[model samples]
Target: MLLVAPGPFALARTFVFRRYLTLRSHVVRPVAAPPVVDAARKARKLLKKRAKEERLRNFFGWCEGCGAYGSIF
Candidate 1:
């Protein structure tokens, strides 16, 4: 595997690449980084939760405590 040789010029190029490049700008930056996540993953989780709630609502027609089989229309 190719390695970064230990030298002043090598270190300078590394610094410039890290500082100016789009991909590694954060590598040079010091900040409170936000957590990276996929929105589609969250959406899928919410969709699953809503679907489960709908199924439960259908199964239990009315208030479980009262045992009233009334339509919530």
Candidate 2:
């Protein structure tokens, strides 16, 4: 087999390519969520949770002593 060693420019190019590959593989990009968007998401989640709790309370009634929803009688 003929072994031809890479020249300086070829070595540099290989190094740059390897670096690019490494960066591409290792870099983790987070999903972009601005503060306003994040706040709106949190508000929506809170509203949904509150609505669920209200529904459950209406159906099962709230237990004062146990501080939980009462059992279905």
Candidate 3:
């Protein structure tokens, strides 16, 4: 119905002739992930892993700086 017709006849040709970019046919960007995003993602993962490791280590012993198990519980 409405989807088959354009708002104006002039626009129909423009729409038909336009080089539409689909998911697979997109103009290639410089890089999908920028250097900063790649670095940040890596840093975030590393920090998360380190935090888990630190928590495990503190559980086994204790962190004097954080005072995780000194007394307050």
Candidate 4:
């Protein structure tokens, strides 16, 4: 609603208005996995793979040396 009033000067005028605002509920949602978490997961997988390869290498090396060291291969 608006109300207009005339002022003393010919070109001067005042305006009055009323504004009504209604509040409503908003929905909240979950976000996807963070970048840091994904990076950490990838790093963990790579480390595990590297550790497994090292273990296998050590085991084979030990096996190759067993017969020459007077132990069962």
Instruction: Give TM-scores for every candidate, taking all chains together and pairing residue i with residue i.
Output: 0.35, 0.39, 0.38, 0.44
Q: What digit string (tens of lDDT, one per residue) describes model 4 on residues 1-73?
A: 8887656663432221111111111223444469977998999999999999999999999877885688543
lDDT of 2 by residue, 1-73 (tens): 9998878699789989999998887676555569978998999999999999999887665445345545644
Off by over 4 Å in 4: 1-33, 67-73
lDDT by residue (1-73, candidate 1, tens digit) is: 8996688688789878866786566576766434434665778899999999999997776457356544543
- Between candidates 2 and 4, which one is better according to TM-score? 4
Question: Using lDDT as the measure, which candidate wins?
Answer: 2
Return the number of clashes found in candidate 2: 0
Q: Higher lDDT: candidate 2 or 3?
A: 2
lDDT of each: 0.72, 0.79, 0.72, 0.67
lDDT comparing candidate 1 with the true structure: 0.72
For model 4, what is the C-alpha lDDT against the true structure? Answer: 0.67
- Lowest-scoring 10 consecutive residues by lDDT in candidate 3? 21-30
Model 1 weakest 10-residue run by lDDT = 31-40
lDDT of 3 by residue, 4-29 (tens): 64456777667665756443256664
Residue 70, candidate 3: how far off, in angstroms?
Answer: 19
Worst 10 residues of 2 by lDDT: 61-70
- The TM-score-based order of candidates, best leading, equals 4, 2, 3, 1
